[model samples]
Target: MRQPSRQGVEQALDRVMRVVTRTPLLPMGHGGAQAWIKAESLQRGGAFKLRGAYNRMVQIAPEDRPRGVVAFSSGNHAQGVARAARLLEMPAIIVMPADAPAVKLAGTRALGAEIVTYDRATESREAIAADLAARRGAVLVPSFDDVDVVEGQGTAGLEIAAALGHVPARVIVPCGGGGLAAGIALALPDAEIVVVEPEGWDDMRRSLELGHIVEVPADAPPTACDALQSRRVADITFGALHAAGARGVAVSEAEIRAAMRFAFAHGLVVEPGGAVALAAWLAGRLTDDGAETVIVCSGSNIDPAAFAAVLQEEK
Candidate 1:
């Protein structure tokens, strides 16, 4: 497989930026650091995943496009794939966790994608997606691993640098499967990129340490940040992250909850995944201890119950 070079990723990002909104980078008000939030939570379909979904869709062969596409995702990616398919007038089948967030599930369905619920314990989503693609003669679009996906994700980095006049001293991204961090690194080859994740769900941290992809076992008391559940790191992400000299860090669940509450209290509707960067910042990684930092608030699909709890806690 060819390497997913920074230049290639930049071109992909260029393609996405033309269609997606430039999410804002508002500073953290606590005066702790030069804090900025790339509010991808406000993106079309409510996540940055749309960029990758659409980027991949646009490149599909016209003959293949008629056969449609299939994907497995718990949230944002499902929404992205569905929305992208809608734009291309292609049929889509989204395999999602039965326990997936209602807001996300409904949004994907609303985009005209047929939904297939899978039993997380009894079924393999990958197998389901593969089977669906085969039966329908459709294309399979992985949530994160693919090179086109990473390139699409990189568009955020491209916009970030352009939005900020250039890469700042550091850019902090909320990492689940590593695509976000991988994309940003390629888009801003000159800036340092860091991956921030929840304490127990840090695949990028373990992957970088092991010098290869690593998986977190399924029995780890599942975290509710559904979009952050990519268990394996992608090869393309590995190369881009390594080339950019990326680093990984984790913040506690308590801190993440607090960050979500803080953002909402300040009129920002960030979900747990969206607030990961802010959570890391609150954990002192982004503190001015003193330096400027950009954090990507990548999604905004908070469960109403969880949102209430986030607000209730830290009191």
Candidate 2:
């Protein structure tokens, strides 16, 4: 498929609004800087994944609807595709990490999708999902690599810009496989796109810096941000981000925890992966660049015990 464009994103916004919630743009400030939070954490399915999932699944050929679809996700995207498929009255199968968050796994099951668990350390979710799709003659809806999905995610940027009456000076998004960042970059050409990833999973960051794709280190350390654990970015996403002149930052575990706590204090509940952009901002990793920035708080489906511990750690 072709790279997502502004027109494609506009079309996606129209379709996505039919099913997804238009999350609000909230104002927040720290030190001398002010920002608008694109609170996608409030979206249906508890994350922005619903936008892309619905947009892609809804467009499946009417004749092929009975065949359903297959996907792979650690959490958020699983819920997205499952929920969408449920709404479409189609069967859905999700290949998920065996150790994925309980809340996420429960959410996917609740949405009526079959769950196929795999060992993240040993098994390839892609290979498994592909095989399932081939076996069932089902459509494979990629989490980030597909053009339709990218366009759907970009609707967030459209909403943000429309709310602000113009493109903000900057937009910071949490990155996994670079879908959201790439989409936002296309949506707001005038704004600087800043992608934030967990420290050890900063393949996109390094890839951008090195001007080529880079896979996550084989011995990468554990991270709480399971939703952002993409091993590498697809060429489609990287091409859009690179063309948009995007920048990147990596957030530490402590920083992500602090951001989660900070968001909670502000009456927003954010997952570890979802809070990375805000984490970078809170940790002073993002300098005062004189831009009216917008940070995407991407998801909210965090496990209760883990959230409580992060909040308690500071107290």
Candidate 3:
């Protein structure tokens, strides 16, 4: 597949803006440091996934739409595809991990998509989704690997630049399969890209450091960032980020929880996965040289109980 381009991202922005919400770019200051938060957590479907999902589904050929679409995601992407399919009047089947948070499962189901659950530790979600799509003659919409999806996700970067009136010196994005980071890199070519991931599942970080794709360790510790738990980094996403000279950092569970609290204190709701970028920033993993910076608050789909518990933790 061809690599996504800025032109492709621009085209995707035009297509997605009609459906995706233009989330806010809020200013945040810590001590003497100032940064802007791209509040994608406030986006429709409670995440930025909708931008790419809608962008991809909207392009399905008319005749092909009848076959519908199939996808695999822990939760955010499932809801994204489900919402997009509903908007486009297409059937959607989502293969999700059985252990995904109840809120995410319920959210996706509420959007009217058929759900297929599998064991994340023992089964491959990609295999299941691909098989289901092949059998049903439906389109397989990957969470982050497709060119259109990457371009669609890039629309967020476009919005960031447009809001700032110039490219920020840097952008910190949470890394899952690297779609958001890659997309933003393409969108803000002049800015430095930094990806943040959960400590045990920092495959993208390791891949960037090693100059090759790397898979998360088989015995990786469990993390609360379910949305950022891709076992391997995809070539498409890695390629885009590597070319953009992106760097990465991994944050601990404690740091993620703290970041969530920080966001809440600021009147924003952030999921664990979505809070990693902010965690990195708050933990001093990334320096603030007074250069303009943007940190993406990617999602806000945590269950009420889970979010409450995190908020109650001591700082």
Q: Which stretch of 10 consecutive residues in model 2 shows the poorest summed lDDT?
A: 306-315
What is the C-alpha local distance difference test score of each model? 0.83, 0.93, 0.95
Predicted candidate 1 versus true structure: per-residue lDDT over 1-315, tens digit per residue: 866667877778667766788888777766434577889988988889999888888899888898999999998999999988988899999999999988889999999999999997888999999999998999999888888888888888878887888777788898888877888888888877889887778878778867777887776555657788776777788767876788888877778888888788777888887788888887676446455678889998877887887787744
Worst 10 residues of 3 by lDDT: 284-293
RMSD after CA superposition, every candidate: 1.5, 0.8, 0.7
Quality of model 1 by C-alpha lDDT? 0.83
What does candidate 2's lDDT look like per residue over 1-315, in tens digits? 566898999999989898899899999987867888999999998899998898898899889999999999999999999999988999999999999999999999999999999999999999999999999999999999999999899999999988989989999999999888998999999899999999999999999999999999999999999999999899989999999999899999999999999899999999999999999998888888777989999999998998898999944
Q: Against the correct fold, how does model 1 do in TM-score?
A: 0.95
lDDT of 3 by residue, 1-315 (tens): 578989999999989998899999999988778899999999999999999999999999998998999999999999999999999999999999999999999999999999999999889999999999999999999999999999999999999999989999999999999999999999999999999999989999999999999899999998999999898988999999999999999999999999999999999999999999999999989876877889999999999999999998877
In terms of TM-score, how similar is model 2 to the real structure? 0.99
- Per-model TM against the reference: 0.95, 0.99, 0.99
Judging by lDDT against the true structure, name the best candidate. Answer: 3
Q: Residue 307: error of model 2 in Å?
A: 0.7
**Higher-lDDT candidate of 1 and 3:** 3
**Cα distance off (Å), candidate 1, residue 249:** 1.1
Ranking by TM-score: 3, 2, 1
